[model samples]
Structures are given as structure tokens and as C-alpha cells.
Target: MKVLVGADIGGTKLALRTTTPDGTVRVDVEIPSTGWEAAPVDQAARWLLDRVRPVLPEDDEIAALGVGAQGCDTQEHCAHLAAAFEALGVSAAVVNDAALLVPAAGLTDGIGVIAGTGSIAVGACAEGTVLFAGGWGWVLGDEGSAPAIVREAAKAALAAHDKRRPDDGLLSELLAHYGVADAPALARAVNDTPTPATWGPAAPAVFRAAASGSASALAVIDDAATHLTALVSRLRARGAVGETVVAAGSVVLGQPLLAARLRERLGSAHPDLTLRLLDVPPVAGAVALARARYGLAGVA
Candidate 1:
């Protein structure tokens, strides 16, 4: 059977799945990302390919392979990934993970918003055109992302610590979750050994505290919703969408309050907008793209 491979590389986890000839999608093979972005592109690719090699058919026709990755949009990034996979005896295509949400939502034309460890919004048109807003990485943009929210909340927690206040709310929850007794310990953790994935898991806790009426947590989540809504608004203002804003990724999906507020704020901004949460992973979109581009039927 002619088969295609689909790989989704997130900030924290890597997911691999394949489609059979009958259009059945196998469940994901989940693994840690393990600093792939910091290593040489080829080295990272080879490492990923090695992990995937065991599952691939020994003699099946490998028609195509598609990769959806975080922070990998440019040609140089694609080339490096391609070379690495090529060394592993597979021809692979790569695109930004954000863009993968487009086809995953099954919308040829609409806006896609993803709030993960980072955040980004993408717009697709019927003419096969794509546009993006936000997603400038955690430091500058990704306003509604887990990392961003955590960074902000951590600051608030530290401020409270500085004021000698009781660790009694969202900040307290975060500090405890990270196993830090105080703000200085948190700072040291950040400097010594911090994972971008570490901050992401606390996003839900922040939302829960906000839902229960923690002012500081509410403020942080409110800002996340506002910033995310602003991206959706920008896409709408540019006349880039019709209806249905696909909400994908970890942060927005995991935090119900953030997701609800985002939709509420967006509806207020544009009454006709519809929010669609993606049921499938981002790599499914890449598989669809490969099928469309290579004239294949489903992914292998």
C-alpha cells in the first residue's frame, strides 16, 4: 500500500501517526521533544527519524512524509529538517506547526488560533493563500500562551513574595507546583534548569483559580483572552476569514476559562464568528496537505 507519514513536533511532545490504505488513522506515538530545537537541525531530524524508524514498513512504498513543527516556517528550517530525515531514508516535507491547524480544522478558508507553550493565529483563503498574526515567539508575542501567562503570573507571585504577603492564591499554587518555596528559588530554577514545558502545565491551575475568583489569576487570564482576541480581530479586520475560528493547541485547549473568554470576547468583537476546537492533532493537517499536494489518498 502507498503510505504517507505524518509527524507533529510540539514544544514539549512529538506525535507520529500513519494512515492505512483504507483511510484509517493510527493513534499517536508520543515522545518528548528533548531539546530538538537547540541542536543542529540535521541532528534533531536524525534523532526524530531514528525514533520513528521502527514503526515504518520495511518495504512499503513511502509515497510522502509531512512534518509540522513549532517555530519552523522558513526555507532554511525546512531544508535542515529535510536533510536530516533524508539521511534516515525518508523524503519529508516540513511546515510551521501553526499552519497545520488550517487543514486539521477542515476549513479551506478561515482563521486558526493556537495557544500552546506559545501562541499564534493563521488565516487561510480559498485561493490557497495563508497569512499569520502574532506567534512572534514567547518573549515578544504569544500573548495568550501558557508560557506567557505563566511568566506573567510568576512575576505577580514574586511581587507578592517581595511584599511579604501570604502565598494564598494563584501565585501560591504555581510556586508550589514548581516545588519552589519562594520567588528567589523560582528565579534560580529559571536560571538553572527550566523547561518551556514546565510552565505550560500550570496554565490550567491559573484558570481554575480565576474561575474561583482569584483577582491576580483572573487578570492574567483576562489579558490572555484579550491578547488572543486581538489576533482574531486583526484577522477579521483584514477581511481574511468567513466564519469559524479554529482554536487549537495546548494552552487554549487545556484552559477552559481562557478558551471561553476568548470566544466571548471574539463574539463581542465580531458577532458572527464561530469557535471550532480541533479534534485532531496538527500533523493531520500536514497529512492533508501532503495528500492534496502529491495527489495521494490519505496519509501512510
Candidate 2:
């Protein structure tokens, strides 16, 4: 059988899928995510190839390849990936990871909002012109992302400390999670090496605290939802209108407090805008795109 291969590289995992041109799924596998951001593109390519190699022998003839990798945003990076995958002898396209949300949500024309380790909003205009907002990474952007949530939670914890009414629960939660003695030490530890894997896990603690009625924690979650909502509005302003908005992210997916707050906020502010939670894993979008490479419908 002919196979279409697609891979989605995220901060925590690399998700891969294979399908027939008619969209019948064949292989689905997930592996750890690492080193996709190295300076040399060949290293990134090898990281992808090593995982997909396991499925190729069983796939018979390969038809096409599609990749929505974490750091393959620029044309230069995409070109590098193309060169690396040339041995596969199949047509391929490299795209940004956030693009995976579009097809994952089952929309050919809609904005895809991602708020996992990072935050980004992506959409294509009717003319097929792609437009995006945010996704500047942890430093300048990714406002509503998991890392940002943890960072804000820490700040809120310290702010309570400055007022001489420190909530022990919030502060202790962060310190224990990061394995630090105090808030100051926790701050140092995080700032020293603030990778997504380091800070993303702490996002759950913030939501848990908010669920327990922690005032500072609630505020942090509220702000996060607001920031994520802004990402959608930004897309609209940039002429990326679509039938619906599909949102996905670890922060939004598992956290009821954050998700509830985000829905309420979006519902109240943008009533006309249709909002749909991404029901499928973002990696499935990669599969859909891969099947499309052969001009066939997706089975994912």
C-alpha cells in the first residue's frame, strides 16, 4: 500500500502518523522531543528520520511526506529539511507546528490557536495567504502558553510575599515543584534555564490552586485567558477570517479552570465568533496535510 507520512514535533513529544491516500491510518507512534532547534538543520532532520525509520519498512511504497515541526518556520529551515529528507524520494512540505491545529480541528479555513509550551495563532486567508500572530517564543511572546502561565504564577506568588501576606500554598507549590528552598531561589532556578520542559509542568499547579479558590492564582488564570483571547483578535485584524476558531494547547486542554475562563471570556467578548476546542491531537493535522499531498482525503 502507498503511504503518506506526517510528523508533528512539539516541545514534549514527536508524534508521527502514516496514512493511505484515501486517509486510512496505518501507523501511529510518539517519541520524545529533543534537539529540533539545533543550529545545524541536518541534526534536526536526523532527529525526525530516526523516529520515522521504524515505520517505513512496513509501509510498502511511500507516497508523500509532511512535517509540522516546532522550529521549521522559515523558508530557509524548510529548505534544509527538504534536503535532509531527499533520500526518501517523496514530495514533502515543512511547516510551523501551530499549523497542525488547523486540520486537527477539521477546518480547511479557520484560525488555529496553540497554547502549549508556546502560544501562537495561525490562519490562512481565503486567498491561501497565511497570517499569524504571537509565537515569538517565551521571551517576547507566547503570552498565554504553559511557560508563561508558570512564570506568571511565580510572579503572583512573589507579589503576595511583598505585601507581607504570602500565601504559603502557592509559594510552596512552586518551590517544591522546582526543587528550590524559597521563592527567590525558585526564581533563580527558572531564569537560569527556562526551557518549556522545565516550566510547563508547573502550569497544572497554577490551575489547581485556582480551583482551590486562591485569589492570586485565579487572577493569573484570568490574565492568561485574556492574553490567549487577544491572540484570536489579532488574527482577525490581520485578515485571517475563518468559519470557526480551533484552540489547542496543553494549558487549555487539561485545565478546566483555564479552559472555562477562556470560553467565558471569548463568549462574552466575541459572541459572533464561532469557537471550537480542538478535539484531535495537533499531530493529526500533520497526517491530514500528508494525505492531502497525494490529493486524497485524510483518515485521521
**Evaluated with TM-score, which candidate comes out highest?**
2
> Residue 198 error for model 2, in Å?
2.0
Off by over 4 Å in 2: 38-43, 74-88, 179-181, 298-300
Which residue window of length 10 is worst by lDDT in model 2?
Answer: 34-43
* Whole-model Cα lDDT of every candidate shown, in order: 0.74, 0.78
Error of 2 at 106 (Å): 2.0
Pull out the clashing pairs in model 2: 23-299
lDDT of 1: 0.74
Q: Write the per-residue lDDT of candidate 1 for residues 187-295, one digit (tens) a residue.
A: 7765465556666677776776677677888888888899998988886666676688888888778777888889889889888888888888887887775566457
Summarize candidate 2's per-residue lDDT along 87-146 as a digit string, tens digits: 556567677788788787777888887788888887876777667778888767687888
In model 2, what is the error at residue 62, expressed in angstroms? 2.2
Off by over 4 Å in 1: 38-48, 74-93, 125-127, 160-168, 237-239, 297-300
